[model samples]
Target: MTTELRNTEFHIRARDGAGAEEHGPYELDIDPGRTADGDAAPRYASLRHASLRILRLPPGGSHTFATGDSEWIVLPLNGGCTVAVGGDSDTPFELSGRKDVFSGVTDFAYVPRDAEVRISSAAGGRFALTGARCSRRLPARHGPASGVPVELRGTGNCSRQVNNFGAAGVFACDKLIAVEVLTPGGNWSSYPPHKHDECRPGEESELEEIYYFEIAPAHGSAGLGYQRVTPSGASSRTGRGTDVLAEVRSGDAVLIPDGWHGPSIAAPGHTMYYLNVMAGPGEERAWLICDHPDHGWIRDTWPDQPVDPRLPLYEAPDADLRPSLNETVEAGPRPSLYEAPDADPRRSPNEAVEASPRPPLHDAPDARPEAHPEDPEGDAR
Candidate 1:
């Protein structure tokens, strides 16, 4: 790759975990303000299509935003809120405060750019409501994932989900493998100091990765964290391993244009979550990453560990909850109404898990590690 393709930066933070615990009841204070973990004005043009706004509501108080040609995901960062989409006077979705909440577990809600969507809450809590000009695509297939959903247990690392976009219904603007992960307290995520700019055996992703962090200080205030990434090849021994070391926090995004990344170290007392967005220019549209030669051996040691205990589930924490969304949505029966939103009217954008099931690319692909125990720290060697 050309050096020009190496565009990257780690916008430093104003202070370490300054607003780790939010406080306020402002309309649009937008407190994060460019801090590493702090929310700030987005630099991407697409952001215009999507506006991420943080609202601080007074206890028992509420707020609303009339909609435009846009959809939104209302996420409560610290406090809880009740989002009344479409002015549902009867059963608007109610989200619990720092408690196990159901009903509002959607990745996001689809609101047309034409209608108005509203939000409300109690006790003036803090919440994040992100807006996006979404072009609704066909929902991905549900049911059992075709390929085995592996349970990776790396040293000091936690559990994670990896989905190659090649599966039908899975969106693919480029070669991107969407991976979600939950890093436990005292654990890490992307480790082993591996590189993937080049394709390799058992690993075939040739795309760049973007890590979007979501931290939960559910138990304490503030934390220490860092992601060690370096350039592979001759650069390691010559000290040119890399010039990048990102100290991230919630809301922070890091772009891995190329190189080896590892040891996503959690601070002394905090938990973390991340969504990995990958994309490349290959026709196969797969995740073909190659590990640094010195570190490929680590994958063999995963069977001894377990997944981080923070992943989401639809069924009774172990059962499939897809059918509970609604019995009459007619996921497979009607291909026109609930199937095509634009062809018809945008039905309830919530509970779309039953739309379609993605096909497994390979019949019997790789044998993924089972639910594993958290790996030990300093095991990334």
Candidate 2:
């Protein structure tokens, strides 16, 4: 690979985790200016069909925009909001968004091409606008958090959590396909090494993928993980390929132009989370892939192994409550949303909400010797 390609293939991108002002193709940090106009101007023009922008709105703040030739999803990274489509004739769809991406499944709204949208939050929130240029215009709609299908895949150390909210066949859209994955500490996800960059008749479809990462913090310190993408070795019409092995942290991202990506590994004590945004030049909106032949045998071994016990990390809103620090023993009704760190309502644009360290959902059996028995600080290795 050329030096330019090699250097850009897979790498960690750092920004003010509190919303930096930097702008580039690989990642777009939250920009306050765009939030006022409902504009998230992503920099990767080469992505061709798709773009992503994160919108941060203060409490009682609102933003409006028109979807000219692209379809989009108002995916909440934190807090809840009301998404109003059309003018004033229809009832706005309400999204009871979660506290943070790793907390649980969140409600989302879909805005079709050529439509007008207005998003307003009673208590302020941050939203991810995942967009794709499209030829077909689908209807404006809302997807309830309760309707998201949470799937647990792989087993043993390869286990992971998948929130198939915008998955193909599960949700309708013109050309956008998205999903969220959570891999627990010491586990590996996106495994069996797969590739969807080839457009085969029925086996595979070429798609450009963006992975937005968020690593769970440990000991009031930073968290870490790893990601790998290898060249497929097959020539393509675009003739693009890459080989990448990178150490990733919260707010980092990896762009896959053409390669076999896999083994998104979480560090021994920090869970890993990634939001996948995908779109392609294919005629149909489908997620098709061919597992790397060398590692395809891994799937056959899944049935023999048991899934990790700490799975199904977060469930549908209506499901029975899972054990959490926020839950109460004598409660009549559990708090439905995770609590975000306190934020001043009148803060300036440069200011960001304080990010509180997320306490572990359950205790791990493989904790280190130095780990505190009660006030656990993780492995710290």
Q: Name the top TM-score candidate.
A: 2
In order, candidate lDDTs are 0.42, 0.67
Q: Which candidate is the best by lDDT?
A: 2
lDDT of 2 at 207: 80
Worst 10 residues of 2 by lDDT: 372-381
**RMSD values, in order shown:** 12.4, 14.7
Candidate 1 regions with alpha-carbon error over 4 angstroms:
1-42, 45-55, 65-71, 87-91, 97-115, 128-133, 137-180, 192-221, 228-243, 249-262, 274-294, 304-381
Q: Clashes per prediction?
A: 36, 1
Model 2 misplaced stretches (Cα beyond 4 Å): 1-46, 235-237, 319-381
Alpha carbon lDDT at 172, candidate 1: 20
